[model samples]
Target: MNGTIHNRDKFLNQIASRLNRPRISSKIQKPKWKYQPQHEVYKDATQDELLAVLEEHCKKIHTDIFTTDLQGLPAVVNDVVANCGGGPVVTWKDERFSEWGLDSVMKKEWPSQQIDVFEWDHTLGEENIDKAENANVGITISEITLAESGTVVLFSDKDKGRTVSFLPKASIMLIPKSTLVPRMTQAAVKMREVYQKTGHVASCINFITGPSNSADIELNLVVGVHGPIKATYIVVNDL
Candidate 1:
């Protein structure tokens, strides 16, 4: 920590000396908004209302959504995988898969059907990334869901490789309905809460709305230019 601060100060001091000004080491204060408009959208909305907002936004982003309860979650996952043309699937090695009661689905169920499944293993190094890149679909659990933009926030870990979501042809996000928020405002609050509790936060926090869309070439819209060609969100109501 001391070395990091020293290096930062040295870099800043060089710039200050070049500009003929004293180095400012104090932290900047965040601006306080008078109206606080960011917190107002769907402030009192129920979970169902948030889901409605997410459903509408998904259409704009060309993503599909499926709602199911805990008991039906396994079926939903299976159907989504099938719809994405069966896998070669890559997923995060997260305990939440079992915690949310889908352990059998990931292990026994899929394997029995002859669908290849790969879990991101840090021990395997870059081999995990290669599997994800070659897979038909990547499955991940959403840390937070932003309803206003149909976005899923992911905090990357060693077991949760960043490539799993972006490298696959299609990405599957398993979102628990209770994780839904009205917009980015609440999501930001949640992230701050995570940081406060852990004393640190993930360096790679992703806010993915849908598949990659680009028009850089000749003003024509194209999908899958920079990421997955298809994206699906499976919202578990009782998870």
Candidate 2:
């Protein structure tokens, strides 16, 4: 410990000497100003228009988009799962799924499907990750959906790990209409509000536009190379 401390001090002193200043032990204050851009696009679209834009962009990016009312969400989810070949499914432990009646619906509709819910206790970390990695389908809830980019914002927490979305062969996100925003700026503002209320932010905030794709290898496009090959968004309209 003493040697490590001495080395750290020597490193800091060398930098301080080069700058001709003494070492300081103070935290830098973050900027407080909000810079509003002069021109903002897609800011005044009606709800219907925003949905149309989202659908168009999603299709362009090769993301499968489905719309349903609250009552029909269960059926939509069932269809998505069925289309994925009746998966061994992994899901985040979110209360919203239960509130939306998805938990019961899955039990009834997909009796043979193996469903695993992730738990973040220390002992279960590796086991949970393995389950997610092996699962055919992974389902998650989108905190916010940016219509301008057709992107969904996912905040990773104990319940929702980063692997839940990236590891599976197919990923499904449940997005409520009320959570849709016009642009990335609006999504960031909502994230800030969440931080302010919770006094903390998640470790990972993923903005996913579509399935993982790369066109860099010999200019040949490949999908799902680094992540899920297929992505689906179930937009709940009557949320």
The whole-model lDDT of each prediction reads: 0.92, 0.82
Model 1, residue 116: C-alpha shift (Å): 0.8
Tens-place lDDT per residue, model 1, 60-88, is 99999999988888888988999999999
Prediction 1 TM-score vs. true: 0.90
Model 2: per-residue lDDT, tens digit, 1-239? 23434588888889999999988768979786686562266677777788888999998778899999877888899899778765778888788887888866655556645444443343586888888888888888888998988899899877778788989999999988888888888887888998899988887999998899999989998998899999999998853
Stretches > 4 Å off in candidate 2? 1-39, 112-123
- Screening candidate 1 with a backbone cut-off below 3 angstroms (N, C-alpha, C), the clashing residue pairs are none
- The weakest ten consecutive residues by lDDT in model 2 span 113-122
In terms of lDDT, which candidate is strongest? 1
Q: How many backbone clashes does candidate 2 have?
A: 0
lDDT of 1: 0.92
Residue pairs with colliding backbones in model 2 are: none
Which candidate achieves the best TM-score against the true structure?
1
| Residue 87 lDDT, candidate 2, scale 0-100 | 73
